[model samples]
Target: MSKIYVLDTNVLLQDPYSIFSFEDNEVVIPAVVLEEVDSKKRYMDEIGRNARHVSRLIDGLRASGKLHEKIPLDNGGTIRIELNHRSFHELQDIFVEKTNDNRILAVAKNLHLEEETKEKGKRVILVSKDALVRVKADAIGLEAEDFLNDRVVEMDSLYTGFLEVYIPLDMLSRFYEKGELFLSDISKLPFYPNQFLIMKDVMGSSASAIGIVDKTKVKVKKMTFNQEHVWGIHPRNVQQTMAIELLLRKDIPLVTLIGKAGTGKTLLALAAGLMQTEDFHEYKKLLVARPIVPVGKDLGFLPGEKQEKLRPWMQPIFDNLEYLFNTKKPGELDAILAGMGSIEVEALTYIRGRSLPKQFIIIDEAQNLTKHEVKTIITRVGEDSKIVLMGDPEQIDHPYLDAYNNGLTYVVEKFKNEVVSGHVKLMKGERSGLARLAADLL
Candidate 1:
C-alpha cells in the first residue's frame, strides 16, 4: 500500500533533497511550508542556501505538470502541493492560534480522514524534525516520525575508534618485541585503517599491548609519537595517545576527534597543529576555525571590528592557544600572534571559496555543522594540507543537528575505512575532576 508523507518546513530546510526520499509514496507539501521556507531564503547562512535549493527543486518539478496536481517523481513517487484543507475547523478548539504548525496539522488531519473513508489502505504520516511538532501531531491523531535519512549511526552504537581484543600472552609478547602485529595473527574480526587496538591476554593475565592498524589494514603497528609531547601537552589516557598518533602522522590528512566536554579534543588538535606548523616547520600556516553557534540566548550583536566582533565566539580557541603559548600578560598573546605571522584564528564563515595549501587546519566544534557545510569546508583543502575536525557530538548547539546526524559523526563513520583519514573518540575528560563530573552528571 502506498502511504502519504506530509513534509514539515524544518525537514526541507534540513535536507532539500528529502522530497525524493519517500520511495514510491505520495509526498504532500502543505502550502504554509513554502511560506516558511521563503522567509528563510534571505539569510546568508546554510539555512538560506538550503531554502533556496528547495525552491529551485520544486520549481523544476513543474515541467511535468502543475504542482497542485499530482506530479510524478523519478523514484516512482508522486508529489503535490496541498492548497486546500487550511481551514482549522478540526483543530480550532484544541489549538486556538492559526500558526503555521497548526495549519500543517490541519492539512495532515484532513488528509488522514479523507484517506480513511476511501479505505485504500493508504497511511498519512507527518514528517518533522521538531520534537514538539511530533507531539502535537500525536494529539491530533496523526502519525508522525523524525527525518532519519541523514543519520550515520545510532548514538549508543557510534564508532569509538578504539577496539579491545583478547589474544594469547605469547602473541602479545611477540607484538611488544617486534613493535607490530599482523591482523591475521589476531582474531578474525574486521579492523578499519588507523583504528586503535588494545590487545590483552585471553587467559586473564595482567599483560597488555596497544597498537594502531596500519594503512594496509593488515598489520597493527605501534604508535610513532606516543611518547613525545606535542606543544607541551601529553596524552593522559589510551584514547588520547591514539588521537596524538593520528594527529602527528603526515600521511593521514584528515582526522576527526569526538568526545564529551573536557575530553581534550580541541586541545589535542591545537597542540598537534602547533607542533607540526611551528616546531617542525612542516606546514606554512596553522589555521584554526569553528562554527558560530550560540549555546544559550544569543548575545544579539557586538560593536567592533571584524576580529573584535569574533572575539566572543573565538575566545575558546584563544584560551587553548594561551595555554599552549603560556602568555601571562593581557596583550602578550595578541603580540605573539601578530609576530608569528603564521597562525590564523577565524570563524568558519570566512573559510569558503578559499584554496588552502600546505597548511595545518583545525576545525573545532565541528559537530555544530551540517553535512553540506562540512563538505564545503573539507573540499576547500588544497594539496599538502591537513584538516582536523574535533568536537563533542553529545553537545551539539545547532538546532537542526543531533549526535547521530551531525557532520563530526558523519565524517567519522564515512572515512573510517580510508587510509588517509583517522578518527578517535576520547573517553576520558582530562581537564579536571569537576569538569568530568559535570559532563557526566549534567
Candidate 2:
C-alpha cells in the first residue's frame, strides 16, 4: 500500500525535485503550494532560484499532461496538484487566519478523511519543515512529520568522524610494540576516516601516546605540527579536528566544516591552509576569500578602490593574519598582503567566470549562502584545487533560513556520504575560555 505524502512548500523550495524523492509513493502538492512557489520564483536568492527551478520542473511535467490530473514522474511517483481540496470550515477553529499554511492543512485533512472513508488503510501524512505547522497538523488529528530528509543525521547520530577510547596501560604497550591492534581489541571504540587516537596510561605514569588511523588501513604515530601550538589552540574539540582533517588530508579533495560561533573553525582552517600552502608548498598559492558580507550595518559605500569596499568583511581575516604574522604596526600586514598579492580576499560576486587551479580555497561565513550559491562556488574549482567551506549552521543570518534548512546544513547533509567529503559537529567553543562559557550558557 503506497502512502500519500503531502509536501509543504518549504520542502519543494529546499529541494526542487523533492517530488521524485518519494519513489513510487503517491505525492500530493496542495494547490496552495503552487501559489507559494509562484510567489517565490521572482526573488534572486536560493529560495527564489529554487522557486524558478520548481516552476520549470512543473512546466516540464505539464508537457505530459495537466498536473491536476495525475502525471507520472520518472522516479515512479505520481504527482497531482490538488486545487479542489480546500475548505475553510475544516480548519477555521485553530487557524482562524486564512494563511496559506492553514489552507494546505485543510487539503491534507480532507485527503486523510477520504482515505479513511475508502477503507484503503493507507497512511496519509503531512510533511513540513516548520515546527508550528507540524504541531497544528497533529492537533487536528492528522498525522504529521518534519521534513527530515535534508538532515545530515538524527540528532544523536550525527557523524563525529572520530573518537577517543581509553585503553589499559598494558594494552597501550602491546599496541605500541605491535604497531597495530584490531578494533576488537577495544570493546567500544567509534572511529572514522583519518581519525586520531590518544592513548593515556590508565594508572597515570606520564606514559601516553597518540596515533592516527588512516581509515582502518594503517595506524601511524601522530606527528605534532608546530602550528597546532603556535596559535595556542587545541584540536581535541570536534570542529578543530574537522578543520585539521580537511586541511591536513591530502587524499580527500572536498571538505566542509559547519558549527556555531566560537568553534575555531575558520582559525583552524586558516592555520592548516598556511601550513599546507606556505610551509609545505602543496599548492601553488594559499588563496583565502570570503563573500564580503557587512558587519552589523552596511556603511553604504566607500570612497576608494575595491579593497576599500571589502575592508569591513575581510578585516576579520586580516586580524587573524596579523596575529599569525606578529605585526607591530596596523598597516604592516596590509603592506605584506600588497607585496604577496597571492592571497586574494575579493567578494564572491567576482569569482564568477573564473577557474581556480592548484590553490587551497577557503570560503568563510558560508551559512549565509544558498544551495545555488554554494554550488556556484564549488563549480568554479579547477583541477587540483581544494575548497574548504566553513561556517556556523546555527548562527545563520540569512533571512529565509533556519537552523535545519540553511544552505550550510543542506550541503553538510547532502555531501556527507561522498568519499571526498567529511563532517563533524563541533560542540565546544575554543576562541577563549570566556567565549566558550558564553557560547555554552547563552
Which candidate gets the maximum lDDT versus the true structure? Answer: 1
Give Cα-based local distance difference scores for all models: 0.93, 0.75
Question: What is candidate 1's CA lDDT for residue 155?
Answer: 56
Encode model 1's per-residue lDDT on 152-215: one tens digit a residue: 9975988888899999999998998999998998979999998999999999989998999998
How far off is residue 213 in model 1, in Å? 0.8
lDDT by residue for model 2 (62-124), tens: 888888988988888798999887987877877889999999899999888878888566688
Clashes of each: 0, 0
Write down the TM-score for model 2: 0.80
lDDT, model 1: 0.93
